[model samples]
Target chain A: MASLPPKHRLQSSAADSAATGQHEHHRPRGLMRWVLTTNHKEIGTLYLIFSLTMFLIGGVFALVVRAELFQPGLQLVQPEFFNQMTTMHGLIMVFGAVMPAFVGLANWMVPLQIGAPDMALPRLNNFSFWLLPIAFTLMLSTLFMPGGAPNFGWTFYAPLSTTYAPPSTTFFILSLHIAGISSILGAINIIATILNLRAPGMRMMDMTLFVWTWLITAFLLIAVMPVLAGVVTMMLMDINFGTSFFNAGGGGDPVLFQHLFWFFGHPEVYIMILPAFGIVSVIIPTFARKRLFGYASMVYATASIAILSFLVWAHHMFVVGLPLVAELFFMYSTMLIAVPTGVKVFNWITTLFRGSISFEPAMLFAIAFVVLFTIGGFSGLMLAISPADFQYHDTYFVVAHFHYVLVPGAVFSIMAAVYYWLPKWTGHYPHLRLSQWHFWLSVIGVNLTFFPMHFSGLAGMPRRIPDYSLQFADFNMVSSIGAFMFGLSQLLFVVIVIMCVRGGKTAPAKAWDGAEDLEWTVPSPAPLHTFEHPPQYRPVEH
Target chain B: MVNVVEDRRPQVRRTVIKTLVVLAGMCVFAFALVPLYDVFCQVTGLNGKTASSAQSLVHQEVDDERTVTMQFVTRGAAGLPWRLEVEERQIRVHPGQSAEVHFTFRNLGERSLVARAVPSVTPSPASLHLRKLVCFCFENQRLAAGESFTAPLVFQLTRDLPPEIKAVTLVYTLYPQENDTVTAAMPDDGKHIDAVATRRWADRSSGGET
Candidate 1:
């Protein structure tokens, strides 16, 4: 083994003479440090805490929506307000909740995983994190505008958005532009840090799945965020200017809006989940005590999924009356996506097969993700059948399919990643029993909430309706109850996380017996600066 | 030193490939701009001929107790029967001008129907101002029992309306409500009477001038 780098060597020598027990440095004092700091770990904490706050806020909006839909007679809010709740709920969850959660994880883990001193562009990292709160504040403030918030669906179709938009739509579009800027910048930072700052001997293939997946995800974000920016900019112009971009009377076709929206939208779905795939890829291997099965294939499969995302957007618009040939093409391309997705699923299951298994909270969530996300994938495949989608489009079936994917797929994975890495972040093991309660309640509440929606949709209930037909009454009641439970269960997660942050059983450097990674090799509760000199890498021989 | 040099080769190659891939991607996406721009044009209705006052309309006052008989004409893609109705049975109109008519509808059977209405106009387009005095399409409406109701549209023919142009049409589509909404024998290209035909009686009373 090589000696520590010169700077660390000096510090360790000084520590050896002076200290007998583990000592932690006082956190940098003052607000100015946070505002101007370029430290990756500090910025990472900011991203995580900000995202958690957004999650709670977005969760409240979801509760509002469920409360209104609880008995189907607009018990709590008007239909327009319900529309705003749904739109803002989706916007905040995707941008504020899931994406930033993953970015937070990246900031915490990337430097350690790659043996880098800090992110390649540390100032940019801080800027990215800070941009989130500003963007979301603008978005959330729109709720109180004169005509109320963006009552259009988060998808924000035309004519509905143009001829009938509220004054706040302009502000909503600008805020999204800001959020897009933040995402693209964060993605660029991740890409540069991963590509340029890895330790001397760490080969591209030698990096952990988390880093590899994030590297690809960063590229995806950079590629598509601008497209989202472009689309929203066009919406802004159409609203303010005399543009007939989506107005039929002005010689524009409304369906064209769907195509552009879904093009950015489809890749965006992957952007939200791909890093979760990275998180699970790391967790599953550690708990199973096996190198991830088919490592090369996993990378290739992820790349394939990203590539396939571009071709399959039209699958979202099966009912928009596309030409037959185009419909057939999109159907086959969408179905083909199932193959790479299957490869990912198969690899995860086989990694777990016949392995000495443990049910740590992180592992528990990962395993649940495997099952629940697959349920979502199957529903997605059912939707891929174009004719069937004609029936399912904008129905509760579609709603069930996405929430299953998003809540369990992205949200659970974020929870799992936090549990997996919390020891490193805090130098303490979280309260296991509280975490278990959080897990079980979330699993039950999430399934109970979304699973009933499939039946309601099959029975011909449309989505986005504040009130539903009486025929859908029973399932809606069940779903509403489930939604409340699900929302409440998430609060338990908040408690567990806060408790973990405050104090817990002190953890050793390698917190788990089987955990193997460069990150674990570092000190518990990693230093403000990490791997100031590149660490050497030796690949595990199978 | 030798191993370092050897490792550097593939790293450089990877970087080069990565660069090329990004460049190629940018190029391909740059090309995509044309189609996306076209799509943008289509979606925003930027490329098609627009009705001068297609979205909102304005109306002039009806002369009190002046029985101004008006005719309605319906036309669109053939095989789709169009319907229209007036919320009020009759309204007084100043000579050489028009007033709002409430047109209501239901698609009795299957195939999609595009409904167009030409109101009797003394003057049209630039000369006449057509105002949507009130409309329910702005909100959701459900028709009852093969039902119908009138969407109120008000307009005044400008003195400039070509005397030959005595009518204006308000067109919309009755896309067959999804199958879930219909509960009877689905018609295969069903033919139904056009509502504008009822205006024929009004036209006869108004001297069948057109």
Candidate 2:
């Protein structure tokens, strides 16, 4: 029996399991249940809760950096603390907040969208979500250590992050290794689920854009997260093992660190946003009451963008003295990426081009995403001109550019996703007036904060500085005020989520009249068990 | 449905193992970039950096079909008082050919000084294949006031030099060993590789002599 082929083993196991019953007949009670749970929805809830917590914690670090940068005189925190703040803010937001939020959404939504009962490997899903808290906790603890946290910034160049690093940098390396392992495991689970678990009639093309995008993003995670693991392992060896992988004095090249980092990093950014693209693609058409303008084109654009991300990493290092040919090559390749990105923007806009259109809280955020993410993209294109990046590299302009793409671009899509699906999860609608207020305030607050950085950066202010000269003082103040306004307003978002969860206007199975995906076909406040017997999947006509 | 779940588990296991293989492959690629980038730089002369440091001279026969122009450029460090002159600005040599070129180092200041010249080759793709039989830049030159010395450079280009490279330039920048200049007046501690010759040069010093 042990040497039997898979078919024979399956037949024997099926006979044994059918003689018994399903294993989740009764779940444990209290906190222990969550600790030991292998259910996808419960793990998704854990991921969301954990992400929300990290988002606020990372936001606090950002606010402290802003507070210190408010007047240019360094009134509040020391330069060292300010450096730690900036570094922690970037690391936490990227690894902790943004990525986990997407994974949480995928866990909750992927199976539902594909008409699968649960994630392919539910135990691995639990393990992946649990790994985040352990990794981040170890990282956050570094701030209390004698030399303080990793202060070379999130891109953490060598020598600075190595020879000049804090004693706790080794711990940072270990934690990232753990997180990288978690990301790979999570990605493997998702790819397995999407490939293996869809209902009988659903073909690859029939899957929702969200599922499709996550599929691509999952592939990206598998490919690049290992590269990240390798680079960090090199950093570990350089730190403790007397290796010189990033040391120039010992025959190693520091430029190699940048090469490996942005290799993983550029794709890591796409990992953050591709799922957001999936989210926005789902929301825009659902509200506009039209079929997505180009479904196949949207999928193709995502793939092309992921592929192009690999080729354009050197654009970030334009000022690092790359050869003329390499610079020109990266510059051209960077510009080529805009074609696919433009396709995505146009697809969303054309979906909104006119039919019956109404602005739900979710749709409003989606619309803002298209307009604002395009602004970030254009600025990115402007930076891609290798000649121009000489002026823009490491300036607040680069800061503003990525923040725009991330906050309004990725974060807004996440918000829209939450707003769109809160009804399904809670069986109640979000408080509309507060949601509108959250929308408007976030729209205004986000723009007010980052938009002025463009001007300040053009005027030659650099980033990661605790203080600046008097001339850049005014712009910093406005940005600080806006950041505060933005920070405080997100509290309203938390409140809306709580309010929706506790009680609100009850929702029907199809929460939005236009919603027609497999998820919406299930009852509101979906039952603990769904698609256990497998639901019939009908391909939606595009 | 039970059969479906049971049947697909093996496939899922297979996909998981394959995905893990891809992950491992990417990890290997990251390390591979190190050698790949080195090879790329060697091929293109990227950044004009020599890919491998020359330790010992290589023995190779010359190819006479192609003649490559070897140019010499010399510059003295900002405060070093040595002037350098090359035998020729550019000399033609065939691939796998060995040739000798001479350089004169003149001490202009009225103090005894020690100097070292660092050499770099351009059209850097040719640097690795240009083996040096003997070169004075490998060691220091000690010159007293009003003293000058002429040195010879012996080298050969490899037989397989790429056809695209028609010319290569070698540049040297000379810098005074400041500590050696200060120690010029001190008693010999016998630490110098050329301690006996350094004493002879110090004996011939004119102004600022010990």
Interface RMSD in angstroms for candidate 2: 5.2
Candidate 1 lDDT, B31-98, residue by residue in tens: 47647766553354332212222232224444343333344433232343435444554444454354
Two-chain DockQ for each candidate model: 0.04, 0.27
- Fnat values, candidates in order: 0.00, 0.51
lDDT of 1 by residue, A310-384 (tens): 899989988765656778999999999899889999999999998888999999999999999999999999999
Q: Whole-model Cα lDDT per candidate? A: 0.72, 0.83
* Candidate 2 chain A, run of 10 with poorest lDDT: A1-10
lDDT tens per residue, model 2, A1-542: 00001121122234444543345346566787778778777787788888888989999999999998889786999998889999999999999999999998998889989988788888898899889999999999999999999999999989789878899999999889888888889999999999999988999999999999999999999989988888888999988997878765344668789988999999999999999999999998899999899999999999999999899888989977676788999999999999999999989889988857999999999999999999999999999999999999899999999999999999899899989998877778999999999999999999989999999998999999988999998899999999999999999999999888888998888999988799998777765545665678877777
TM-scores of all predicted structures: 0.75, 0.82
Candidate 2 lDDT at A206 equals 92
lDDT of 2 by residue, B1-210 (tens): 345567689989988999989988998898898778667756765534432221333456667678999999999876778898898989999887788887878889898788776676776557767776556664567788868877667678887777888999988777555345333322223334234333443343431222
Best candidate, lDDT:
2
